[model samples]
Target: MGGLKVLCIAIVLINGQTIGTVAADGPFPDEARRMRSANEFLSPALRAEQADPIRNRGMLWVEQGERLFAQPPPPGGAQSCASCHASPETSMRGVAARLPAVDAESGQLVNLEGRINDCRILRQSLPPLDYETDELLALTAYLTALSIGEPLTVSIDGPASAFYAYGQQLWSERQGQLNVACTQCHDQSVGRKLRGDTISSAVPTGYPAYRLEWQTLGSLHRRLRSCQLGVRAQLFELGSREYLALELYLKSRARRHLIDAPALRR
Candidate 1:
């Protein structure tokens, strides 16, 4: 079984601190409580799309991803992902909910896109795909789409704890000339409109998300990079440890939130 396969079925704990369920975070203050769930703050139009994935434009990427998953790999490759896994519905359902799993071979944490790249290089005998490319997004969206409606139950205990802590630090620490941390906008200003968009919880439930600005489905790292650029900070490499760490942290915060990949965002 794959690394994510085991975690998805076996470990089912909420990855981070939950509001009211446990002692809420003190550093976050009462304002943070307002940002409990991404579902809470959305316009009627956008929220309608969130509830109906079938109508969402991002589903176009998922259809592309489905075709890509079954097609044979480029010349000289062993086989396509579908050749080994059979149906994505049976094998990949809920897989994304457990992602950014710990890589047993390297002991380094890897996100869904990074894991897909690693598999292509090692298993498919192909070069790593470029980050944020359409192919990668398609594949990621297809798999993550299977897990839609399932809660994010990524483990943050034991081997994953260190990465979680580092991710937590990064989430709290301010960056850039503006001196704003993710906590400032997401945590402090949950409902407030920042440049016309309501501030979300920074939770990672919706990813491989379709942003009106991008006009396409994009990876979570892409969104994070936007946040960095917004704050005037140096952008990390797409699949860098920093992005992965931040991803883990964000997923943790969205503990019980259902997977909403390829979601539309304004």
Candidate 2:
């Protein structure tokens, strides 16, 4: 083991007055320890499928996303996402890896999905897309795919620190009838066989991914809810603060791991 991983906290000041406390780096795994992507644990056949765009079922959603990105805003709208962001390959590159960030305006955490909906509602003058909708998943998968190979760098500083702490709490706290904590499975039993499936490190980099069990692409929150159900816990609403905070903590654990969105999972 290397040096202890420490949480870095800072105090915000204004005119020599302490305003608030911020955590620059929440409690994270040791820096010297390498965190592997969930893709590394994939079966050879599924790995091959994930690698080949033509063979990957998740790519279908990506394609739909591309079309949706270029689609014009409804009548009377100012511009489409394409009009503002231009080519996603050029403008949107590496964007996904930095999400679940605190929105400056709302001072609330917003993931990639939340950001997209924000654009639609505020800029495009359209209604927010529903969670888990084909349109939302497609667009999210498309943007995430563009960040393939990019390392996760989600921030957990400032107001986000509180949320990160909550997420950390949730990760370690035992819940549900089974009284299972996320750490017991993801951190302690990684690589172990679980009902025919190998446990992963609970990385968020591979979502909105294709899951054979679901037979379709789904968001990280959806998967989280599934885990809750697996342990006989109550499910939280999609896009809820609890899940968003948990997503932030999960991404922080996967810091520097290359993104594998639109990934295939058994």
Candidate 3:
């Protein structure tokens, strides 16, 4: 288990307040409340005990991801993820649980898909895929499968310490023209309606989720950026340091949430 010493210290200094369950607000606040009222975060034991049907579906995605990694696009310049990821079980071991990680060089926290696209751009020299694209989903499904029973872990050590602290500050700080913080909606009024849709608790265990509204699957970072944009807050570039730092902070909050990919959301 990776200890979040820096994260804890930073959180204490930044928040200086009690941590409570996400609040309820919005049009369908009741529905949101119903969704998370008795929510039990996904634990290692529960992950191990999950029924075969669910695990099988996850496995199917993993297998498809593996195939996608092998299939080259057009004039094959470089191979797919298998060229490096190698064994899905071994290469991706414990990866999903450690994601939304802080990158040492760039000093940013990056989600699983962000890291993958980074690899694709740097190692493979291929253009990064759009968020929640089929390629990204397959890869996420495959990597997440490797840590089905492992505990989620994100580090806030060394260079990441400062970034994590920055993220924590961002999490608590109230801003935007609406003068509302993410906590106000996500944590404070967790079960509520923004417009016509229900406000979920905003857990991040799942990524590259299939959304009915978008009619496509996408990464958590994309959603986060969208949220920021929605609030008319400052929008960071994809894979930017500030964005990544915020990602790490958010993942820490969803320590034990279940990974629900291919999820249907409005």
lDDT (tens digit, per residue) of candidate 2 on 1-266: 38956444222110111111112344545630445467767878888877776778988888788878987877877779998899778699889989899988898999999999999988998888998899999999989888776768888788889989999999999999999999899988988998888898777778998999999999999999999999999888999999999999998877766677787888
lDDT of 1 at 183: 85
By summed lDDT, the worst window of 10 consecutive residues in model 2 runs over: 12-21
Model 1 lDDT at residue 105: 84
Off by over 4 Å in 1: 1-35, 52-54
Per-prediction TM-score to the true structure, in the order listed: 0.85, 0.87, 0.67
Residue 235 lDDT (model 1): 88
* Cα distance off (Å), candidate 3, residue 98: 0.5
Clashes of each: 0, 0, 13
> Which candidate number has the best TM-score?
2
- Candidate 3 ranges beyond 4 A from true positions: 1-64, 72-76, 105-107, 193-198
Residue-by-residue lDDT tens digits, candidate 1, 96-193:
88888789889999888887888788888878788788899988988887777677778888899999999999999999988999988887887788
Worst 10 residues of 3 by lDDT: 9-18
- Each candidate: RMSD to true structure? 8.4, 13.8, 13.3
Clashes of 2: 0
> What lDDT would each prediction earn against the true structure?
0.76, 0.82, 0.59
Misplaced by over 4 Å in model 2 are 1-34
Q: Which residue pairs does candidate 2 place in steric collision?
A: none
